[model samples]
Target chain A: MSEKIKFTIDGKECYAEPGQTILEAALDNGVYIPSLCYLKDVIPAGSCRICNVKVAGRFMTACTTPVAMGMEVENDIPELNELRVSIIEMLFVSGNHFCPACEKSGNCELQALAYKYTMMVPRYPYLFPEKKPDSGNKKLFIDRNRCILCKRCIRAVKDEQGRSLFAFKNRGNELAISLDHELAENISDELAEEAMEICPVGSILKKEKGFQQPIGHRKFDKQAIGSDIKSVIK
Target chain B: MSKPVVATTSLAGCFGCHMSLLDIDERILDLIELVEFNKSPIDDIKVFTKQCDIGLIEGGCCNSENVEVLRAFRKQCKILVSLGECAIMGGLPALRNGIPIKECIDEAYLNGPTVSENTEKILPNDDELPMLLDKVYPCHEVVKIDYYLPGCPPRADLIWNALIALVTGDEMELPYEVVKFD
Candidate 1:
């Protein structure tokens, strides 16, 4: 048993393990912190910055910040609320994300967060960047506009598959996530089932799986991604 | 004595769209022969008033500054092209939907543990700032878009085809691989 630390989240004092994040502690205690780029089992990459909370006196990402003793955390501060909204805005402009028409509408973290935050109207003009529609790979489509380049897919390629097919390209708002081969060779038709299982977003999915299961009909068991993504490693 | 002026501008985006343009690799020389870059991110040229044959606009209009740049390009160019998902669909940053603009700014500057006081700045002149569209929109919604090459950043072939179409004056056709979300 590791050392236990106590922290106050949303006015509730709870005990958490040493290495766990504030998000883990809160979720463990039945408190929900809305997150998009976070998936259990895989190492936490706080790129999306959606799971923000006020720690002690400052706002911090709940997913990346480790637990500390006697820390007073405010999970839903006005400022933290604002950050979540901004991060979502950034995600919206970076991709062609239309939820009502998307397959992942009901289950989409982006849409769920919008509903939670009450982002009823878009505060910015639609950019409509010139983008190429779904590329030839039918199993999944890469909408450059919708990708925040969280690198989770790139991380999935490296951590789960043991192959570095995806690379983070360029810098600033222009940065994009890309795969080396035209079609991800390692992600063969057989392995695609597993790839879809590992990918966190609509970026990589099975071609045959589209519009088959209404997002509402899908069952979310909610477990770690330990063996699922790494099935291709060997 | 006639080098067609081509302009490029980046708006509220990560600049990934311009990088995708470089994916052209060796064929860039052939492209330069047809048109010269007037206000590209690759070059230092920022301000442009001359009429450009093609205006390649990247990034979504997120801030007042971004909207000004967009309108400027639209006014000067003979053909306005939306270059990536950001320019076309408001990109990922448009996710700020439903959340208040004040709240969005709060998250970036104050609430997070990495707070920097400098992140706090007076909101731009509300009148100057382009009003937020009801939702993220494709390029055709805001301005008269002459050609649209869809992609997060459109693939190389689609981009090249767009250039070819502009120079040759052909109709813009949706490529086979392009997925239409609208």
Candidate 2:
């Protein structure tokens, strides 16, 4: 068996394999490092900065940084958490996040994070950028208005040929996520559901499948985003 | 303490937030005993009779009249609270924010699918009519909003807790389940 690398996260003793990223090792050690855009089995995108942790007095993404032996990392300090909250607020203002009208309001990760942070209102000015929705697909609709461009769907959802079902189109100021012609062919209900589930926001939605769960029963309603992991740890 | 005078208004909103306030149920009796209403649809008071301690504003500013009323609320109330998603972030009406103002008006009046009655294409522009703003603006964008309770209509319990805290000077308990955006 390979020797485990020892590390300290918020002064708690944690162990990791040589190649394990901070986030992976944290999970292994029953610690919850909040994240978006980092899905299981998919290559880490490190795009969403929600998993940012201070390492050696500097900030680094837990999802991408490999754990180093004897490295001290700060995970849930107030300073780092405030930064995370600001990012959540930025995401809110930069999109048309009409949570009241959203189908994914109760279950959305972005909205859950905002709740976790107790963000009463975003400090930044609302951008209100115009974008269109594509409902041409039978099972799904891709609403770019709410897309944060986290690339979670582009990274995770794939076809039988190993092609990404979602892709980033256009450039800066006009960057958006688009669904592949994978929808044109026989797209499975499972795949449509997966795309919608993979999205951190309500951008990817299974058409006609909204508000199915009651208010109190929805995910993250009674608990926080990473509460399940924390509960297991406790 | 004169029962912590309270006021409320609905601008470009659907009045759902006001209905949620009423959803406080039997607590409405306790709330009325604790605070006084002024310039609110709840009491059918069209004008502010006096300065208020708390002002709960629902909806964003979609027209010149909304701006004027919001300014009046700010000037007359000591603590102004944005009471819902519409007041907090312009809500659904703000969907038109990215679209051109002319395009929006033209579509609503001259070119929409169900607008068959107007061959003359008359747009309401009387002096008494409020002029449409270029885009819907959140309460804080127009005036100083002291607090913001988010939701389509923030959960009734959330509203209750906030009011109780304001009236009793106690710390508000934001239970995760009640603090929803929907």
Taking the tens digit of each residue's C-alpha lDDT, what string does model 2 give over A1-234?
A: 889999988999889998999999999888888887788777898998999999999999999999999999999999999999999999999888988788888788999999898999999999888888898788888898889999899888887788888889999999998887654357888888888898888999988798999878888778898887752333
TM per prediction: 0.51, 0.96
A35-68 in candidate 1: lDDT tens per residue?
Answer: 7777776678888888888876787888989989
All models, DockQ values?
0.03, 0.83
lDDT of 2 at A227: 82
* TM-score, chain B, each candidate: 0.81, 0.98
How would the docking of model 2 be graded?
Answer: high
Q: Cα-based RMSD of the predictions, in order?
A: 20.8, 1.6
| Candidate 1: CAPRI quality band | incorrect
The ten-residue window of minimal lDDT in model 2 chain B covers: B173-182
